[model samples]
Every structure is written in C-alpha cells, then in structure tokens.
Target chain A: MGAIYKRELSGYFNSAIGYVVLAVYYFFSGLFFYLYCFYRDSASLGYVFANMFYIVMFIIPVLTMKTFSEERRQKTDQALLTSPVSLTEIVLGKFLGAFTIYALCCAIFLVYGVVISFFAQPQWSVVLCTLLGMLLLGMAIIAMNIFISSLTESMVVAAVVGMAAGLVIDTMSSFSKLVPIPWVQFVLEKIDFLNYYTNFTYGILSIVDVIFFLSVTGLFLFFTVRVLERRRWS
Target chain B: MIEVKNLTKRYGKITALDNISFTVDTGEVLGFLGPNGAGKSTTMNIITGYISSTSGTVTVDGSEILEEPKKTKQKIGYLPEIPPLYIDMTVRKYLEFMFDLKRVKLPKKEHLDEVMRLVGLEQHGARLIKNLSKGYRQRVGFAQALLGNPPVIILDEPTVGLDPKQIIEIRKLIKSLGKKHTVIFSSHVLSEISAACDRIIIIADGKIIADAKTDELSGVLTDKRQLLLTAEGSAADIQNELKKIPDVQKVKKTGESDGAAQFAIEYKPGADIRRDVFSAMTRLQCPILEMRSGSESLEELYLRLTGSVKGGEA
Candidate 1:
C-alpha cells in the first residue's frame, strides 16, 4: 500500500497533472477570496466556501481521472494485482494519493485565513468548520471519482463520467424542486450534498453531516474494491 | 513446485481453458507450447493470480492461490504477455518500486544491480522506460520477474519481440534460471521450447494434447520409421532393389546427384532395414554413398499434435 501510494503520488508530479491541479485550484481560491472577502471589505470566508461547489466538482475528477484507469490502460494493473499486496491496500493507497493532493490544495485556504488575520479578527471557528467541510466533501468525491475511474480504461471517459456524476450530486436539491411528486422530492432534498455542507459553512459541525460524508466515502471505496475484484473474474 | 488441477476458464460463452491440469517439479523448466490463443496466457494468468479461473485451483508450494494469494504470490514471480511497465519512470526507479511493492528483504541496491546486469540492462538503468526500445522494455520486465528471487517464476512469451541474438540470450537466461527456480515458460515457437525446456506441454484449442520430456516427445511421435539412402546407381535399379526388402513399407525416389540416386524408405516401426538395403545395393554392384535414419522433427510433431496437418501427411 505504501509503495503504490508513493509511486502514484510521484506519478502525479512526474507529469504536469499535479502542478496543474494545484495551480488551477490556487487560482480559483485566490479569485474567490479576492471577490468575496478582500473586495467586499469583509473577513468572512463563508461566501468563498459557498461558491467553491462548482470548482470542487470540476477539480476532483481531474485529480482522480488517472488513478486506476491509467493503470488499466497501460496494463500496469497486472503487476499490482499479482503482487503480494491485498486489493484493499491498493485501493486505499490510490485514494490517499489523490486525497493528499487535494489536501494540499485545501491548505491554501489556511494561508488565505492567515492573510485575513493580519488586518482583522476573522472567525476562526467558522473558518476551521468550512475547511473540515471541504476536506470531507473532497474525501467523498475523490472516492466516488476513483470508483468511476476503475470502471473504464480510458482516462477521458473516466474524467467525463466523473464530472457528470459530481454535477448531478451537487445539484440534486435544485433538480428535486422540479419533481412533481412530494415523496421523491423529499428524498432528494434529504440526500442533497449541499444541504449537509451548509451546516459547516455556518459554524455548525453536525455529527450527522460528518457521518454522511464518511459513509459516502466508505461506500464508494468498497464499491471500487469490488469492481476491481470482479474484473479478475471477468 | 507448482500444481494446477482441473483448471477451467470461460470468458462468457467462450471457454478459454477446458479442464487442463499439469504440475512442475522442483528445479525443472517446463514449457507451454502452443499457437496463438491456445490458453497459454490464460493458464499463466491464473497461476500468477492475475485472473481467476472459472472452476479450478492453482496450488503453488502447497498454498492455494485464491485462498492465500499473498502467501502464494510471494513465492512466485510473473511476467505477463505485456511487460507492465510505467513509462514515466526511469529503469532504476521502476525496479526499486517493484522491489518495495514485492516486499523483498534483500539488500535493494545489490539485488537490483545484479538483476539489471543479468538481463543486460546495467547501462540503461538511468534511462526512462519510454525512451528504451522494445527489447529493452522486455528486458526490464524480465528483470522485474527476477527481483525477489522467488522460487517459482512464470513468464508468458518472454521473447516475443526480441531479435535473434536477444532471443538466444533470453533462452540462455531461462536455462540458467531453471537451476535455482522452477520456471514455467510459454512460447509459440517450436525450436525455442525444444531447446530450453526439459518437459513440454503442448496445448491446442484449450486442451493439453501432449505432455512429455522434450527428447522423448519426438521419439514417441515417430511411430513410423523412415530411412534416407543414396546409392551410386540408376533410379530405377535403386527403386527396384529397395522394393525387395520385405520390411520396407513404401519407397519414393527423392532426387539424384552425381550419378547417385536418393531414395526415402518408410519401414515398420520395429524393423531395422538398413543392413538389408545395404546388402541389396551391394548385390547390385552399387556403392551406398549416404545412409541415415530420420525421425519426425519437433516441428512436425507440433504440427501433427496441434491438428495443423491434414490427410495424415505428418
């Protein structure tokens, strides 16, 4: 697991993907900070966090599109599968490899928080809560996108499908309003990802919301492992 | 060192391997000989635990592959049909990653350097795999299989794209590896198998058609003995004289050179008709120039066993 994680993490930097992901992520975060906090003469990070939904959706797929799909496409999965490592370890190694990059991207927000602190007393509780929210959301999305990557050999197809799935999940509540049936609408609103994330943005670290994100992450990771195991039989 | 029993694999409606079973003893080089799509890769894949068999089990060193994958996989090294290399990594880094992935306990630097030297990749270790040629990529793959020094090594067509010189070098490497490891090598080329393996398993259409010692396979397949004779005489006289031997089943005039007639004589398997033919030629005042016994070559045996020959020509 450690070996795979190290190789995968280095693989991102070996190409331009790691640096590009960081650059794009930092650029968007800086833009949102400038427009929402610096230009507005306010120190609140809530507006910046609230507007990051689309950026997170777009960036997570790019971060994870090559996790397993590249391995499958290059036939490198044979070496990993035939090695002494278990399937669970391989999946976790890949998940954490991408998660580490996303975590680095999130760290930029801490820098922004420090910069805001120089001029005014920013709300530390809200800032930490929103950061936790972003990390948890990233965990679930990375797991889900990694699962999508495992289903196909083409990295392009993985990225496209991953983006599509993220968009639908992120906008489930808005789509729920369009449904005529009350029960279906109620269920979609209940499962809406943004609804759970709203609590963290308002300085409320709800246990139920944390569990929801963790469960989603675990469920998708389990599904990824099963998909890889099923491919052997295939 | 390895045993496969009642192994069967099916890709949907297609049966890739049909109840094929074989075993390799310790310190033996076993070759899987077949044409393309003959379940050679399928069997190796199952043994290496890269894929699962539909209804079968592979036991390596007394541990079942599926039930105890890590334990069994630790005991064997596999080189698949495609060498499973990361193109972005330098040869040294790629091998080091494999070393760590396999969890080998040996001294990493010395072991990797020795493997690189073994496969003639010592000079190319610092180069990226993407810049290396196909033969060099194959050598890197071969070096990976030798990393942990596992007791059992399974290679699927290890010399597919190499030139003739490199092919011979790989063959020699396999021969040397057999001394320390139980090697299961698969190849579609007939001479490659015959030259390297102690025992050969001929698979065709998802079935094991023939399994015998390399030399004994050819011996067992030659049921009808043939003798080639060249005598200093007219073709008609040599043909007529050859017909007088009772054991001679059929005789055909092949060619003539320097007033010598060449005749191919097919005799019953148990009979020794050389002395009779020599005496007949001596009685006819014809000196026998060349005479040699001919058995079915490995190529003919492979062709016949794989059902490529038609009308019993083999």
Candidate 2:
C-alpha cells in the first residue's frame, strides 16, 4: 500500500496533471478571493467558500479521473492486483493519493485566511470550520470520483461521469425544491450533501454532518474495491 | 511447486479453459505450448491470482490462490502477455517501484542493480520506458518479474516481439533460471519450447493435447520413424533392396536428383535398419551417397495437435 501510494502521488506530478490541477484550482480560488475579500474590502471568507463549492466539484474529477482508468488502460492493474497486496490496500492507497492533492489545493485557503487576518480580524473558528468542511467534502467527492474512474478504462469517460455525479449530488437540494412530491422532496433533502456543507460555512460544526461526509467517503471507497473484485471474478 | 486442478474458465457462453489440470514440480521448466486464444494467458492469470477460476482451484506452494492470495502471490512472479509497464517512468524508477511493491528483503540498490544487469538494462536505466525499444521494454518487464527472486516464475510469451538475438539471450536466461526456480513458460513457437523446457504441455482449444519430456513428445505422438536415402542406382532396385531389410515397412522413391534416386523408407519404431540397408546396398552395388534419419518435427507435431493440419500422421 505504501508503495502504491507513493507511486500514485508521484505519478500526478510526473505528468502535467498535478500542476495543471493545482494551477486551475489556484486561479479560480485566487479570483474568488480577490472578488469576495480584497475588492470588496471585507475580511469575511464565507462568500468565497460558498462560491467555490461548484468549482471544487468540477476540478476534483480532473485529479481523480486517471486514478484507476489509466492503470486499466495501460494494463498496469495486473501488476497492482497480482502483487502481495489486498484490494483494500490498493483502493486506500489510491484514495489517499488523490486526497493528498485535494488537501494541498484546500491548504491555499489558509494563506488566503492569513492574508485577511493582516487587514482585519477574521473569525478564525468560522474559517477553520469551513476548511474542515471543505476537506471532508473534498474527501467524499474524491472517493466518489475514484469509484467512477474504477468503472471504466477511458479517463475521459471517468471525468465526465464523475462531474455528472458530482453535479447530481451538489444540486439535489435545488432539485428537491422543484419536485412537487412531498416524499421525494424529503428524501432528497435527507441525502443532499450541500445541506450538510452549508452548516460549516456558518460556523456550525455538527457531528452528524461530519459523519455524513465520512460515511459517503467510506461507502464509495468500498464500492471502488467491489468494482475491482468483480472485474477479477468476471 | 504449482498444482492446478480441474480448472475451468468461461466468459459467458464461451469456454476458454475446459477442465485442465497439471502440476509443476520444484525446479522444473514447464513449457506451455499453445496457439493463440488457447488459454495459456488465462491459466497463468488464474495461477498468479490476477483473475479467479470459475470452478477450480490453483494451489501454489501449499495454499489455494483464491483463499490466500498474498501468500500464494508472494511465491510467484508473472509476466503477462503484454508487459505491464508505466511508460512515463524511467526504467530504474519503474523497477524500484516494483521492488518496493513486491517488498523484497534483499538490499534494494544492489538487488535492483543486479536485476538491471541481468536483463541488460543497466545502460538504459535512466531512460524513460516510452523512449526505449520494444525489446528493452520487455526486458524491463522481465526484470520486474525477477525482482523478489520468488521460487516460481511464470512468463506468458516472454519472447514474442524480440529479435532473434534477443530471443536467444532470453531463452538462455530462462534456461539458467530453471536451475533454481520452478518456471512455467508459455509460447506458441514449437522450437522455443523444445529448446528451453524440460517438460512440455501442448494445449489446443483449451485442452491438454500432449504432455511429455522434451525428447519424448515426438515419439509419443508418432508411431513410425522414417529415413531418407539418396543413392546412385535405379529407383526400383533401391526400393526392392530396402524392402528386403527387416522392419522396413515401406520404401517409396521420393524423388530423383542428378540421376540419383532418393528413397524414403518407413520403418517400425525402435528398429535399427541402417546396418541392414548398408549391407544390402553394398551387395546390390548401389553405392550410398547420403542417408539421414527423420522423425516428425516439432512443427509438424504442433500443427497436427493444434488441429491446423488434418488427416495425416505427424
């Protein structure tokens, strides 16, 4: 698992994907930071956090698209699967590799927060809470995208499907409002990931929301493992 | 040692491997001879735990592969039909990654250097795999399988795309490795198998058609031995004289060249009729120019067993 993790993490940087992902992420986040904080002359990061939700959803699939898809396309999965490692280890190693990159992207927000601190005293607790929420949300989405990547050999298909799935998860609450059926609305509200995410932006660190994101992350990682195992059987 | 029993693999309605069972004893070079789509790679995949067998078990070193994959996989090194390579990585880095992935206990730098040297990749270590030729990439794959020095090395068509020189080098390496490791090498080439393996298993249509020692497979498949004789004499006289020798089942004038007759003599197996033929030729005053014994070549035997050629004894 350690070896796979190291290889995967370095793989992102070996090609242009890692730098490209970070660059795209930083450009958007920097633009949002300037618009929400500096141009407006405010210390609040709530608007930047809220607006970057959709950007995170779109950008993360780029990081996770080639996780398993490239390996399958190149037939490198034979080496990983046939090695003396379990399915769990391979899945987790890949998950953590992607997660580390996403975490680095999120860490840029800290520098943004520190910059705001010099101009005006910001709510550190609220800022920390939003960062935690962003990390958890990124974890869940990265895990889900890795699962998408595992289902196909085409990285393009994985990215498109991953973005579609992310859009679905992010917009469930809005879709629920449009639905007239009360039961469907209630179910969508119950499963909406954005609802849980919105709480942390306002400094509400609910344990239930944390658990919800963690469960989703774990569930998708499990699904990725199952997909690999099923391929072997097939 | 490896033991595969009752192995059957089916992809939907198509059966790839059909109830095949075989075992490789310790320190044996077992060549899996088969034509394309003959379950050679499928069988290797199952034994190496890359895939699961539908209705059978593969036991490596004492444990079932499916039940204890880590333990079983540790003892076997597999090179699939396509060398699974990361072309973006340098050859050295790729090998180092594999060494770590296999968790070798040997000193890392020395072991990797030895493997690179063994595969003749020492000079190309720093080059990206994408830039190397096909033969070099294959050597890198071979080096990967040799990383941990596992007891069982299973290579599926290791010399498929190599040039004649590289192929000979790899065959020699495999022959040398057979001295210590139990090797299962698969190929469609008949001479490659006959030259490198101690025992041969010929598979066709997912069935074991022939299995015997390298020298014995021809004798096992062919019931008659033939000798081609060229002599300066009348064809009729040569055939008549050759038929008089005991165990000479049939003698036919095959051809005439430079006014010399070429007679093909079919004899019973295990019979030495050369001395009798020589004496008869001296008595008939038909001076012998050339005489050579012929058995079924491995190529002919392979074609016959694979059902490529029909209605003739190999």
Candidate 3:
C-alpha cells in the first residue's frame, strides 16, 4: 500500500498536471481570499473556506483523473489486481494519494488565514472549523472521483463524469424548489453535500455533518472496491 | 503443487473453459499450448486467483482460491500476455511497487538487489520502463514475478517478441527456473514447450486434448517400424526383389541420387520390417549404404492433436 501511494503521489508531480492543479487551486483560492478580505472588507476566513468548497467541485477531478483510469489505460491494473494485495488497499491508496494533493491545496488556505490575521482580528477556532470543513469536503470529492475513475479506462471520461457527479451532489439542494412533492423537496434539501459544511463554516460543529461526509466518502470507496471485485468473477 | 478439478468458466453462453482438470505435482513444469482465444490465458488467470472460475474449484497446496484468495495468490506469480508495466515508472520503482504488491517483506534496501540480480537487470534498474528495450522490459516483468520466490510462476507467452538470442536466453532462464519453481507457461510455439517443460498440456476449443510427458507425447503420435535403405540396383529390380519379403506392405523407389537408389519401404501395421529388408539386400548381393526409419516429428504431432476439436454435444 505504501508503495502504491508513493508511486501514485510521484506520478501526479512527474508531469505538468500536478503543478497545474496546485497552481490553479492556489491561484483561485488566493484570488478568493483577496476578494473576501480586501474587496468585501471581511476579516472572517469562514467565507473564504466556504467558497473553496465550491471550488472543490471543479478541482478534485484534476487530482484524481488518472487514479485508476490511467492504470487501466496503460494496462497496469493487471499487475496491481493480480498482486496479493487486497482490493481495499488498492482503492484506499489511490484515494489517499489524491487526497494528499487536495490536502496540499488546502494547506494554502491556512496561509490565507494566517495572512488574513495580519490585517485584522479573526478567531482561531472558526479558522480551525473552516480547515476541518475544507478537508471533509475534499475527502468527499476525492471518494466520488475515485469511484468514477474505476468505471472507465479513459481519463477524459473519468474527469467529465467526476466533475458532473460533483456538480450533481453540490447542486442537489437547488432542485428542492422544483419538486412538486414536499417529501421530495425535503429529501433533496438533505442531500446537498455543501449543506453539511454550512454549520462548520459558521463555526458550528454538528455531529451529523461529520458523519455525513465520512459516510459519503466511505460509501463511494466501498463501491469502488466492489466494482473491482466483480471484474474478477465476470 | 496445484490441483484444478472440473474447472469451468462461462461468459453468458460462451464457455471459455469446459470442465478442464489437471494436476501439477511439486516442482513440475507444465506447458499449456493453445491457439489464440483458446482459454489458455483464461485458465491461467483463474488458477492464479486473478479471476474466478464460473463453476468448479482451483486449489493450490490445500487451500481453495475462492475461499482464501489472498493467501492462495501469495503462493503464485503470474505474468499476463502484456507485461503489465507502468510506463511512467523507472524499472527500479516498478519492481519496488511489485514487491509491496506481492506482500513480500524484506530488508528495506535488499529486495531490489535480489530481484535485479536474478533477472540480470542490475544495470538497467535505474532506467525508466518506457526507455528500456522490449526484452529488458519483459525481464523486468519476469523479475516482478520472481519476487518473494513464489513456488509457482505462470508466464503467458514469455518469449512472444524476443529475438533469437533473447529467446534462447529466456528459454534457458525458464529451464533453470523450472528447477525450483512449479512453472506453467502457455505458448503457441511447440518447440519452446518441448524444450522448457517437463510435461505438456495441449488445449483446443476449451478442452485439454492431450496431457503427458513431452517425449511420451511424441512417441504416441509417431508411427513407424520400417526403414529407408540406400541400395545399388534398378527401381524395378529393387521393387521385385523386396516384394518377396514377408510383412512388406508397400515398397516404392522414392528418389535417386549419387548413382545409388532410395527405396521407401512401409511395413504392415504393427510389423517390424527392417530385418527383412537388410537380409534381402544382403542375399541379393546389393550393398546397403544406409537405412533410416521414417517417423512423425513433434511438430506434426502438435498439429494433429490441437487440430481436432471436441464434438459439440452440449
């Protein structure tokens, strides 16, 4: 597992893709930090992290496009799958590798928060909550991308599907008004991934929100394992 | 040791393997010979636990692959048709990753040296797999399978595209590896299997048609008890003279060269006619320059064996 993780992490930065992901992530994240602080004249970093959650819908795919898809495209999945290592380890190693890059992008958010404090008063507790929210959001996005990556050998298809899936989960809350049935709208409202982070961005740590993100991540990873396991039998 | 019993794999209606059963004793090299799309790879895949058989069981040592896939797979190393290489990775890194992949633990720094030495990749270890030649890349794949010293090594077409020199090198390597590992390599080439495998299993249309020692298989397919003799005589004289011998089913003048004649003598089924031919030539005062038996070769045997498919009874 460690070997796969190391190889995957190195693979990201071996070409321009990793640097591009980090550059674009930090560039836009810094741009938002500047806007939320200087343009809007706000000292709270929660708004910056909140907007970053939306950025994840677009950026996470870049980090995960080649996670499993490229392995299949290059025909290397035969080696990994035929190895004695269990399927769970293969899935989790890829997840953590992509998550590491996401975490690296979030690291810039910390610098953003630190830079914000230099200019005005900002609570460290809310900053911590925002950091936690950023990670949870990124984890959920990574899991979804890993699952999509497993479904095809084409990296383009994986990226497009992953981006579209994220948009689906992110925008699920907006469709609530269109639903004619009250129960349907209620379910839609509860299904929003971003809604879980609203409390954390407001410095509210709801146990339900933590469980939701973790469960979503776990569910997708479990599905990815099952998909690979099924290939051997069929 | 491996035991496969009534092993079958079906893709909806197409049966990739039809109740194929074979057993390999400890330290035996079994060659699986089959044409394309003939279930050679499918059977290897199932035996290695990379895939499951639709109905039936594969047992390695004593544990069933379906019941303990991880443990059973640890006992085998498989190299599929394509040497599953990560092109972006260096040869060293690929081997390192495979070591972890095979769940083999060694001293942090010693595993690489061991594998490189075994596969003779010590110098090319630092090169990217994409940069290495095809032969070296295949050696890297073989080195990956050699990691942890697994008892059973399954190679699918190990010398598919290699040059003659490299082919000989790989054949020698497999022959030496056969000394210790229970190796099962599949190939469409007949001479390769005869040279490297102790036992050969020929499959056609998803069934094991013949399974026996390589030499024994050759014996069963060749029919002979007659001899071709070089005699100084006219064609009519030799034919009329040889016809008088008993058990001579047919005798014809085959060809003439060097002012001597060659006669192809065929004996009756289950009859030894060499003694009669020699004695008749001696009595006729004709010198017998040479005599040789006409028999089937291994290549002909292979063609005859795999050419026939099972009847479509199902």
Deviation of model 3 at B74, angstroms: 1.4
Ordered list by DockQ, greatest first: 1, 2, 3
Worst 10 residues of 3 chain B by lDDT: B305-314
lDDT string for model 1 (B4-89, tens) is 99999999999999999999999999999988998999999999999999998899999999999999999998999999999999
**Using lDDT as the measure, what is the rank order of every candidate, best first?**
1, 2, 3
lDDT of 1 at B251: 94
Candidate 3 lDDT tens digits, B1-314: 89999999999899999999999998999999877888999999898877789999998988888888788888888888889998878888878878877778676358779778877899987898888898998999899888888889999999999899999999998999888899999998877888899999988778998999988965665454456888886657777889988888778777898767898787776777778888888777778888888764444555666664344311
Q: Runs in model 3 with CA error above 4 Å?
A: B221-303, B306-314
TM-score of 1: 0.88
Clashing pairs in 2: none
lDDT (0-100) at residue A157 of candidate 1? Answer: 95
Reference-based TM-score of each model: 0.88, 0.89, 0.86
Clashing pairs in 1: none
How accurate locally, in lDDT, is each candidate?
0.93, 0.91, 0.84
Q: Which of 1 and 3 is the better model by lDDT?
A: 1
Q: Give the Å error, residue B165, model 1.
A: 0.9
Give candidate 2's error at residue A198 in angstroms. Answer: 1.2
Clash number for candidate 1: 0
